[model samples]
Target: MKEKTSSNAPTDTELKKWQGSSVREKLVQLQSIFETTKDAKLHTIAIGSSHVSFFYLSSMAAEEKIYDEFIPKLINAGEKSIKSMLEAVDSANTGELQKVLSEIVSGKTAVFLNNEKQVYLITFRNKAKRSIEEPNSEHIIRGSHDGFIEDLESNMSILRYRIQNPDLTFEVMELGKKNKAKTAIAYLKTSYDPELLKEVKRRISYIDTEIMLTPGYLEEYIEDDPWSFFPQMLNSERPDRVISNLVDGRIALIMDGSPTVLIVPTTFFAFYQSTDDYNSRWISSTFIRLLRLASFIIAINLPAFYISIIGFHLEVIPQELIVQMKNSVEGIPYPPIFEAMLMELTIELIREAGVRLPSPISQTIGIVGGLVIGDAVVQAGLISNLMIVVVAVTAVSSYVVPSNEMSTTVRLLRFPLMIMASIFGFLGMTFGVIFILVKLCKLESFGRPYFAPAAPFNLQGLTDTFIRLPIWLKKEKSNKTGSGIFNKKKSSARGWEKNEN
Candidate 1:
């Protein structure tokens, strides 16, 4: 018998010709096209005696024999699982390629051959994943006990599980010209503002970058203006957080391989929210939300405020407290800003070093670093006791931001305000504050107002904006209707007093 080879295999001349072409072209030119999927760990290709099994790195399970045995059993169960492919078989594709890949990677198995135009889908998906855990950054006592995981399907499932209405739509687009990163846009088709959805989709679709390694990549690409320091998109890992936005006429984008989900068409207020708000007592939720907002203001302005109070406006503080603050500053030679900046920088260094170091050393670094540095700096007469207090409060306040991105933005923005206050005192600090507010006003996330329901003043949204009002108050959905709260009141509430005597 003569040996046989695939006729499509490229020769030397053809291979060289494709060398100048793009990666996709080069891939198609080869005998086995699956080998060129970039993620070498994935892109599995096994040529068996009976059939060619082409699938992803993680999808194929058992062995070549398992399919042979299982296919026959599926037919006997009255399932037309694989009529032509097998006597009995189980199959599921749902007609979407993205969905197919997601299902397969999450545990389902798909089989394709070299000569086949269509693929055989099977439902033998078995995933081993970590048990659901709290989101470290967005942890709250009262929120849903769910969080996003690295799996894209798992993240989408989180959203779907919460908002199980047909009007909720999950639209996906491939980003990164080469990487082909999967990005899913989710919004309530009926509840979402058409203009808002269209604009978000437009910006996302226009992301022409080469690589979208994370949600941050797509975040930056779709930002209204790149230079703005304020985050145009709010990213969250909490499923409840994303669901809340979806119900409020917002869109969310989830990227594969990232635990974080991006909530688009966001306002500044969204970053201040947590899942706990909706879950807690109304009063407590309102109070905590207010505290978080106040903390943000205090965090960003505390150091600058200290400088202005001590260096420029001494009359503002009580005389007794002034005496104490002055006593605390007695030996310090540096100005309030310098002292403040030094301590802040030290704290940041300790924080960053702690993160980069091993767990054992990082804890020691945080404790020892704080004690040694604070004592040494005080002894060295470089900063005042009051400045230390200011920096400490600021650092703690920065942590109050639910989103890490917003926290970082707060920290970074604080520095410039500190510098400005240091140089020109209260006038400089005032200017910096005004600049930030103006910059925020100019910022937009996917064309919707970023300062919204606040800047645009959607009074109807106030019930759930800064405070999570009782469910009854929030029962009336946003004006954009389609996928929001309906009936304006709960059956439980309405039934309570309606049958009085």
Candidate 2:
């Protein structure tokens, strides 16, 4: 009996060598490699008196397309060779066992002719996927309603539809060892910084892992500071958003099986800007933009600020209000810190429970938990009325942030500030803020400063950072060139004077 090869044995070089010309021998080798899985199918067909063996995974291969369309075409085409008969788009002839195995696993059927050295691999992937719909997470009041689906090709097509420019380039690469998930890097060839592109490619190539489940897994490997609370790369399901970032000279990474695509070298300001800002009038957009910025501050600082004031700085309150506040918390059993933590934890649990349950049931839970349970807690004197208002406002403010990752970061950051405020009162919260600022200043996103137009202080870039400047007035500035690339002479954006009577 032939000695069986170990499954863990290296097959890179061995697979490159042709596995004997015998069809039955090849079948035995493939069955062994695939562990005789039921999904691995071998279909035998006689094409013009030549017996050909077609191998593919039933779960991945398009069964109807293969049996009806491809097989009939092959049988009718009385070509001299198997390669000539399988002359479809993306069709290739290969002798290497490695190539044949890879093609079959990737939803391509491999046609093996008896006594023939080469195998014809044809692409026939047709998997069921979710239909294109507006993303629930990044919904906009006015804009393109379509969002990216799980299929990488569909996502790329959506991006192509938005920007038909030829300069927009996409380079594909494979990640993960066992699964080998496909990943694509997209960027405008004309605008993208060469160094930035090289850096992104280098980082992705260096990701050594066994399995990459989603873009989030790859993100953890590529981000500059993995420990930082702020996400260096922005994740979005909207194709328009991806196109906009690509136009801005940034690179986008789209992973197979993940609906959300990632944008790199992003600034803190990018997270705050919404697609609605571009759709609406400049004045209204600017107002909402400023409101979002205010909400960020309120979300992170409100709880701690309340804890400091009520616990330490009672003198700040007016006499009548002070009396009212004292009366409100008079019967509360626990300290301010304990009371705040308990309410925060309860809200977090309810929020999580709502998220985990079905949509209709979750909505019911939110109403009952937010109103009924909150009122019960107040009446029981477990938490003060002011504390309830503070927690609710903070939660609402957090939702105002456009990026979900940033919103989550804001929620997580409050815990440390709350702890500090409990121990050191206002001083503790002040120190926590200072530490965060220092960290933000030190952080880098793909080697670009995270806090741009604010820390490094770019006047031209600042025009659109906090406020939504009119698109016509906004000048195209190269992120790499800084002020050197700006046009010296300013033209009337609207050309209103030329039309004047």
Candidate 3:
């Protein structure tokens, strides 16, 4: 039997005093603190002549290791302290009760020694997690299939394997007051801007929330423009994508339990880029990049442009097209705006259904909703045949975007543009275009221009924006200075030619 403290009802200050005279008193205090939780496991065992108390969360801690390995080894070791008896792969001694509790919650077994007034935190965390698999959203034709997993340590290992440089540094901090989530900020120390890093850290520290569920939740707090439709930070599940951004002097935020990592200070063009671009030939990559850019424009304004030209600016269309469009819309009851809205809403509903249902069912819903409903609506004379064609083309174009967030933004932006076109014709679309351009120009990602290598144009950065130049032609420069625009400082990839000859 171990000694118990005299004070039965200890104050908060007394409870915090980890240097209690008796291990039983400390154990009682901890038990009282976690009495409401049924999963909390406290086991009392004898190690040598001293009494040892082990505390861990049953849901998270490895029970097999504790029972099979730790207990057997501890009982066999004679006349040894609790710390000396256990042969854990990793162990740490701490006197603070708060630290001990934290370790227990984090899936480590906390061993309390009665004789020494010391606590040893042993790591035996073996929680089940999803194996690393290719990301469904950011799929590529020819690249590494591996992606970030829900496990933070595994994600860190993936990053470390790609970039083995000493300059790759990670600064970790916990976020949220009640549900503390681990977050790590990764950057290349040699190339990343010190000011930018400081700003990012400051913003993270400023976040005072009760719970952070995902990286997306944290993103809203850290973003410069929360109201803007455009995403300021790039979210990627691919380690290759994250590694590429890190090499470009950008900072990456990796949150525990979230496969998606956020890369900061990104430009609009970055969202359009796919991992396939770097893997393919430069000319082919350039063509695909340009095609995606064109898709962005078409996805946003195709319906609106069609409405404006047919309704108000029919003179601009060739006489034969005007005649064809007039015949198509002649029997339709609703105006161009109403017709467009109906189709858009239907498509959105189908899309939402597809997402919520199972994979096979979702595919069925897409085919049934798209083919059956769309064809039926046209045959019923509810929507014009030409309008169906226009909407179909627009939907296909939106799918071409590499980033899902950007694709969503493109989908949303067309509604307002369509309304504007209905009221003011071609003039409304021009104003809408200008408004979007100005917003993009004004938007900043961590104080760096969001519409980089374009508005406030940098001629050099243009090399890889709409068209990717050959890797050999690409120059190495500080990301802080160019800010996505290439500068005059260049390196020759053919410098070894003299030695070869």
Selected candidate, larger TM-score, 1 vs 2: 2
TM-score (all chains, Cα) for each model: 0.79, 0.94, 0.94
Tens digits of lDDT, candidate 3, 1-501: 344553233356855565754677877777776666668889987755677778888998998999898778777765454466654448888877666766777789988777567778888897888988999998899989989989888899899999988899989888976556889999998778898899999999899988898999999999999999999999999999998888888999999999999999899999999999999999999999999999999999999998998789888888778788788888999888999999999999999999999999999999999899999998999999989999999999998999999999999999999999999999999899899999999999999899987977877788888888777766675668333434344446666865785
Candidate 2: segments with Cα more than 4 A from true spot: 1-20, 79-82, 481-492
lDDT for every model? 0.70, 0.84, 0.86
Worst 10 residues of 3 by lDDT: 1-10
Q: Candidate 1: misplaced stretches above 4 Å? A: 1-83, 86-128, 358-360, 479-492
Residue-level lDDT of model 1, residues 1-501, one tens digit each, is 334342323346764564354433333433243344332122333333234343543333533434555544433433223345531356643333444445444445555444433455665544446666777677778656678887777887877778788888888777775556877888887667888777777777677776689987777777888887778787888888787778777788898778898876777888888777778788998999999999889988988988888788889988678778878888777677777777888899999998899999999998897777777777787876667677878989999988887888899999999889888888999999999888777777766677766666666555566766676644545635212343444546656677888
Q: In model 3, how many backbone clashes occur?
A: 2
- For candidate 3, report its TM-score: 0.94
Ranking by lDDT: 3, 2, 1
Stretches of candidate 3 exceeding 4 Å from the true structure: 1-14, 17-21, 85-88, 481-491, 496-501
User: Over the stretch 194-250, how does candidate 2's per-residue lDDT look in tens digits?
Assistant: 999899988888888888989999999999999999999999999888887887888
